[model samples]
Target: MRGSRITRLFRTRPMTHETPYEADTSRRRPTVLKALVFIVLMGLVIAGLLAAATLLRSEEGPKIAIAEPEPLAVSVIPVEYLTELDIDELFTGIAEARRTSRLGFQTGGRIERIDVRVGDRVKAGQTIARLDTRGLGAQLASSQAVVEEARSAHQLALDTADRQRQLQAQGHISQQRVDEVVSQAATAMARVDAAKAQADTIRVQIDLASITAPYDGMIVSRFADEGAIAGPGQAILELVEGGALEARIGVSARVVSELVPGDIYTLEAETGPVDAPLRSVTGVVDPSQRTVAAIFDIPETTGVPAGSIVRLKMERKLEEKGFWVPLKALASANRGMWTVYAVVGEGEDESWRAQPRLVEMVYPAGERAFVRGPLEAGDRIIVDGLQRVTPGARVVPREVQRAEAASGG
Candidate 1:
């Protein structure tokens, strides 16, 4: 009965908020909340410790600093003192004869025979063509007949004059009669002299009927054919003197200005190169090409032909001051200029580096170039290791030996 009464009291107390069951529930809820708070605090402390440990470990490790690369090794070519620069300019030209002539007959006539054809070589005074002299022959014969008749009459008059003079001296004739007879003889002699002059003129015309070459040359063109009537001074053939030849080349004003007569040059022909001397340079420029005409006399025409294409080569020495550098040292720049890397600084100094400088190319001779730029007189330019360097990069400059430099190594 006491147990039952106790159970009933417990059940009835659970219905009230201030009962022992409610107090126990409230205290259990607070204890459970406090335990959760302690677990969260412990977890927070562990996380903080792990983070601190990681930081300490990273600090304790060795610190590695990245090192800079070594300077690039390069060979340098010293800037040379150059007083003059040589420039080569090649010009194309056609070979021509030193002397050319268009041969023709001195008088008009019908062409009868052509002795030579085009491309036939003829010697000096060789007849290249001839005209039919049938008409000239008839005229010459008539002139000769007239001259013979005049001479016969003159001879008779002379005899008569001599006889008359003698008779006058002997008093067989008066002075007036002698004078008249002498005057008649003089008139007859004058007629003979006129006839002789006419005959001589006809002979000269006959000789001129044959067209002849003026010199040893080859016939370049034939303007007249057989049976063609040619007028006086009409061209019948063109001749080119083959012995002495020349090449006429057109060059710019600058190049022509450096050329002078009597200077030796070179002519690159199909056979080989031949020496040619400068003959003439025109003072006036050509209106169409804006270039000056230059004539060079070839030494020999053994392997050269007239009207053949050839190259005229000239090495002009320029007065501009510059320096010669290996072709490998040059770097292309804008406006047709170039760049070069120069090692500038004292020995073993940290400031020693490659500096790029602009340069103007004056001429190129084989593997070297004459250049003018902002470089000093004795600047050391980097020739090797150009591809491995950049502007302002440190470089170890090793001077190239004289022999190697000269050999363009």
Candidate 2:
């Protein structure tokens, strides 16, 4: 009966706020809310204790400090600023003697002797070779005999004419007889002159058969040999004048305009480099080659031989506003523009970063280039280890001295 009564008390029906069941429910609701609040407060206290334990554990060990990355060490060189660059142009040429001659005998005859070989050096007036004058000796002797006989007859005629004139004066000879003796003497003297002229003609023929070098030269070729028959005007030997050399080069009009005659210039030869003076410039351009001829006279003691391949080195001003930079410092970029890694900083500060500058390569000069655009003087640029660098990267640049850079450091 008591348990039934308790069940009835726990089981309540809907009623007005003034009923006992309503009062009990209200009181229980307040107690349950308080218990729920206490449970949440206990959970908060436990979480706070756990957090404090974590803080104590974290503080028990040594602290670690984060470190920044080290800067890359690189070699750098300053941009060599310049407004002009010399464009070296080499024109191919041939070294030749100042004078070349093809020597020959004036008259046709058999070559009796050849005193000079194909490479013999001879001086002026040196007899190179001579035609065999032995065959003409008999003819010369005959001429001489005729001249001597004529001279003897001419002396006899004079004596006879003198005797006749004396006889005519002494009245021992007629005037017509004296006149005939004078005429005979005059005829004998004419015979002597004719004989002397014949002998002189033979001597001239002998002189014409011989050959002599007209200048100091070397025999470059021999077209005729001993015992070979050569005609008049046929080349017997080819001679090139020594002690003077010249280069004949063809150059464009633009290049020729930059050259001045009588200026000293250097030339490349098989032997070595030689200094030559500009002798002349053919101002007219060739119709076929469209190039003008430039003549340079080499020094006598240069040891450059004739017929050697040669070259003329000419530098023309490009008149460009650019600076010189090593090729290693240049990194190719987009749209044909090139980038260079330059280190910029306060002059005395060691903290420098790599800054990329856009440039145009105007000319390529061996290991260097002429560049312009977005670059300034005194800007140090990274040269070594280009493949390992990037823009705005921290770098420790070791500046390469000007002398070291020039020596290919």
Candidate 3:
């Protein structure tokens, strides 16, 4: 019991160096445990960052796809009803004088002197040329001498008849002698009158030997010169009536009926346009051309000579119902037919479809056409960008303003 008590007393005594070292180890153990725990938490945070980076590298988010192409944008125009159409037609014609004539003398003779040359203007009743009058002068002088001699013989016979009548009453001469003297006087008087008539006939021939102008005119050509022998009815000069210009145009019956006589119309001359009066129209149709001759009196100031080519323009109106659309809007279809695409629905969100309408071309004027089809007024038709447009194809409607050209030229 005493040994045990001594040992217990020794254990209860103050600590030594080894004992201090054990207490120090126990204090540092908590710090080492805290450091280990900090290292583990940092490793867990790094692991979480690595996992997030791997998820970002993978292409697992929402994807993007190319959008469908937008509908073809096109230009369009509104079509309307065409009540009537006017077609312009140009007719060819020639400018000429109102009266063209070949002038000659009434009698055959040698031309003495040509008073006028070609392109000479003359007045009515003016002498243009003369023939030799030497032969006529001699014959006229002989006729005068015969008339004088016949008159002297008639006076002598008359004196003899008076004396014989007085002698018969006095019974100195017979009545037969008086009758014979009276017969002689009558025959002489007849000869005198016949001679005078012959003289007058020669004088008239002298007047007819010369060429005179029948009216105011110009000589366009000369067929006979001075000292040229010309026969009657042979052309000596080509005379055109002066200051009277005209045009002879051949026109169709349809056009001829529409033109009224005395109405003014326009003509394209060599210089420029001129207004003239319509004179007449021959209803007789030419077999070759199937046209009638229409006479228009042209103004003299136009300076158009004969045989000059001229032009006449006219507008013909036809009664028809149709629509005018751009040529670009037309598309060829089966069996030689044409079609146009018309937009039916009219809204941004609405589905507008290209509907083809069978169209018959009434007339084509330049880049536009007048057509008749199964369509209504205010129908929208695609004009440009036609390559992308097709029948029954969905399209985006973009309208364009344009003027309707319906005139057929």
Candidate 4:
């Protein structure tokens, strides 16, 4: 019985024992299979995430943004509703004398002396100069001697004729001899009369040697000096008569109709402006230039030199009230046709936009222009930066007052 119990205990102990290699093999096979399954699942998840990222990127739309507009700098003049101001049409012209004369000697002679110089004032019939009178004096002396000699011969013939007449009446001498003496006496008296007339002519010729001024005027020039030979029709000096000056201006045919004689005008000189009256308008028109000559008489004023340049301003008949803008505001698409850009308000927040407006320009006044348009008073217009502006474009209104203050207006 002891031996059988020992065998059963040994078998039961042996039944709990196993090989190490077999245990390891079984555990490693399951672990490797679980690892492969985990790798496959992780790979599928990563691929799905990459595909979703690519699709999201391709389906996205473009990003858009808007920027604020830049502010504009501008200047503006106030518009007011006032009475129509009569603006004169200013014309550029030169000043001249109303009556200018080139004084010269009527008779040729050597200049003995000059009594007047430039800027010298003289009166009418004033002796301005004298010439050499040596030849003239000699001729007058010879004429006077002939007159004396003829007078003596006439007296002797008169006495002889009277005695002969008395003798013939008393029959003391032959009639033919008395008649001969009477005819001689008559011829001698005729010779005396001719000699006296010739002497008188010579006397008058000597008086013209002195050159005198024809009217009251100021001497503007002196062409001949002392001892200079002066010929006939040679200008010796220049004279401005009547103390009146004039300006000769060329007026176009379109404006010539408004100019007439006795119209008043203003002339701008270096000193200041002066009032002048229109003297005359030339009837003959210059065919080549299509202009007429306008003459304005300037009043006598001190220091207003003749031949100086001046500008003439004349009033026109047609007048109206309109906006006067600078010439740069006008744009030309064709000859005589002009347009400008005007700003019209669209809404309170949207501001105004540029709108092309047509105008008819009548004439130019200095740097400003006078135009006729459908726009009324207080219309805002762009005077500068017109090329960048277009119709229906959004713009930021830059206050003109603020810009002017910044620029030290």
lDDT of 2 by residue, 234-297 (tens): 9999999999888989998988778899888888899898988999998999899888999999
lDDT of 4 by residue, 294-333 (tens): 8888787635677888777667555565667788877875
Could you tell me which 10 consecutive residues in candidate 3 have the lowest summed lDDT?
400-409
lDDT, model 4, position 372: 72
Off by over 4 Å in 4: 1-73, 76-85, 88-100, 174-176, 242-322, 331-333, 344-356, 374-379, 385-396, 400-409
Q: Is 2 or 4 the stronger prediction by lDDT?
A: 2
Q: State, as a TM-score between 0 and 1, how close model 1 is to the true structure.
A: 0.55
Q: After TM-score superposition, what is the CA distance of residue 46 in candidate 4 from its true location, in Å?
A: 46
Provide the overall lDDT of each model, using Cα atoms, as 2-decimal numbers.
0.85, 0.86, 0.84, 0.76
How far in Å is the alpha carbon of 165 misplaced in model 4?
A: 1.4
TM-score of each: 0.55, 0.55, 0.57, 0.60
Tens-digit lDDT track for model 1 on 51-145?
Answer: 98888789676777998677777898778777876677788888888898888988888999998988899999887788999888899999999
Instruction: Candidate 1: count the clashes.
Output: 0
Q: 1 or 2, which is superior by TM-score?
A: 1
Residue pairs with colliding backbones in model 1 are none
Question: Model 3, range 109-209, lDDT digits (tens) per residue?
Answer: 88888889988999989999888889999999998898898889888888988888999899988888889988988998898899889999999989988
Clash counts for the predictions, in order: 0, 0, 0, 0
lDDT of 2 at 300: 81
